[model samples]
Target chain A: MDSIMRVTVYIKIKPEVLDPQGTAIARALSDLGFAGINKVRQGKIIEIDLDKTNAIKAVSDTESMCERLLANTIIEDYSISIGE
Target chain B: MDSIMRVTVYIKIKPEVLDPQGTAIARALSDLGFAGINKVRQGKIIEIDLDKTNAIKAVSDTESMCERLLANTIIEDYSISIGE
Candidate 1:
């Protein structure tokens, strides 16, 4: 088929991992006087366009990429989505 | 009615604003020997837990938060989703 495929990966710190950035944002919101903010978690979104045709291959490829460079598996978790 | 609402905010760089970080990511992916990576863009996902029950109020509050601090609207654009 050889149609260009689009992938989106979301990477976030594991719940067990402390996210200073998220904490900072929560604090900043509190400072700004915005009430009712119980928690804030920050994550990264990576959108990629691949010159591949197969959706399954694209998902596998994206997962490998996340394991290798996109995410730190020890403290971060990543999920890959294809064609969206 | 006071129920916890989860709000998700996605902030992305304005298309006109050059994304050096995204460029670096693409370059890194290329160096890692993954082929067919044509374009890459990086964005931020902020998950917020608010003690608000009204969906409309939560959305409006989130939009204001993005305008005030969560996003740099000058060079970035943000989208907010509630109860998801």
Candidate 2:
């Protein structure tokens, strides 16, 4: 059955790679008088809808999507979550 | 002990709001020959480090950060996850 399924992908920059944007957020929070703040890193979250009911296949396809476009393997790391 | 703790914040656009970036990703995937794609939505993943050992206090402080700056409550919704 070609039913709809949902998959979520979380992408984050590599630890070694500098995250200036995230650093900026940390500074901004500090400027706003927020205390106890240390470091802040930001990433992208993508929720995809696929016309496939099989959970296993959905995850497989999503991994391909990540390897292809969803993430930059050179400087980013990605994790995939499927089903509820 | 003032050890560092990590808290993750997930911010997503309200369902009613349009997400062109997500839409573009879906279309791009289709053009690249990947099929069965229906829809896609994008969000933000913010990982915050705080100099607090208490998990409870960390979440509370992060929530304030969300309400104050991280999210634009008008068109977005955010959730927080703490510790492992």
Candidate 3:
């Protein structure tokens, strides 16, 4: 029998890392007619699958993977979630 | 006059990019007790703001932008959506 887990992580640039995508989006917003959209930032969402007997432990391991390999802690921050 | 539109683009590997993240997730899924989860591929979601008098045109422009700049057409594919 095999088990599966779905992990989604969102990674975004540090505020200081000039976000061209965000800027472009902001400009597009102004063009579209929405006002007061002061700023925008772009990010990435990564979904992973894992096998483990314990759901809690699997999530923890995925978090560690994010911290260790998936994201650069120095310039990026990430959020993680686990599901069936 | 100002306008605003929200655009979301999802980018994924072309199935041959050797997705280590997807591989990791698949392993995690088996560990977490989910059975029959065959394959997983990791991707990114980019949200943008656009300004245009016409919603239809805005969506089209966003799609072109995705093709020209946002995504690598050779190794990636993208989907775009527009909103308020």
Candidate 4:
């Protein structure tokens, strides 16, 4: 039996980095009369389905994946969650 | 004092929607030696900072925003989480 696991990775640009999409979102919200919104930041979520069943190994692999290809560590930060 | 709240929204494509980016990511990962990864899905996260302190209102507003602009309901599903 294959021990399949799902991992969700959330990646966001560093605070200092300029996010044109986020700025555009905020402006659009204001135009839509949702003026209470103070700030908006846009990011990405990557969900990976893995064949590994071991929880610890899955997470470790996912993290390495993030470091190597999933995220740009110089300008973004990411978080990972493992699910059944 | 203004009650500020943070809301995180996760948006993903409908299962039936073709995800080229995800496919590309999976292929890239395979090229990088992470061949155990079976599938991948790519989505977006939008974090909003609201001036409204009430948790309920913050969530409601965020949902409305998602419907209006943050997400394309036609081919996507979104979930919202509120944080301090």
Candidate 3 CAPRI-style tier: incorrect
Look at candidate 2 and tell me the lDDT of residue B39.
Answer: 93
The CA lDDT of each predicted structure is 0.91, 0.91, 0.69, 0.89
TM-score, candidate number 4: 0.92
Computed on C-alpha atoms, the DockQ of candidate 4 is: 0.89
TM-score versus the correct structure, for each prediction: 0.94, 0.94, 0.59, 0.92
What are the per-residue Cα lDDT tens digits for candidate 4 across B1-84?
A: 657788999899999999999999999999989867889999999999888677888888888998999899999999999872
Question: On a 0 to 100 scale, what is the lDDT of residue B53 in model 2?
Answer: 65
Interface RMSD over true interface Cα atoms for each candidate: 0.5, 0.7, 5.4, 0.8
User: For all the candidates, what are their Cα RMSDs to the real structure?
Assistant: 1.7, 1.7, 6.5, 1.7
What proportion of the real contacts between chains A and B does each prediction keep? 0.88, 0.90, 0.30, 0.92
What is the C-alpha lDDT profile of model 3 across B1-84, one tens digit per residue?
A: 556667677788886788887777767756765554456777777766554446677667667766766678888988776652
Per residue, candidate 2 scores C-alpha lDDT tens digits across B3-77 of 888899999999999999999999999998889999999999999988866878888888899999999999999
Question: Given candidate 2, what's the lDDT at residue A45?
Answer: 96
Per-candidate interface DockQ score: 0.90, 0.90, 0.21, 0.89
Best by DockQ: 1
Model 2, position A48, has a per-residue lDDT of 94
Residue pairs clashing, model 4: none
The CAPRI class of candidate 4 is high
Mark the regions of model 1 whose C-alpha exceeds 4 Å error after superposition. Answer: A1-3
In candidate 4, what are the lDDT values of residues A1-84, reduced to their tens digit?
557789999899999999899999999999999967878999999999999678898888888999999899999999999872
Off by over 4 Å in 4: none
Worst 10 residues of 1 chain B by lDDT: B1-10
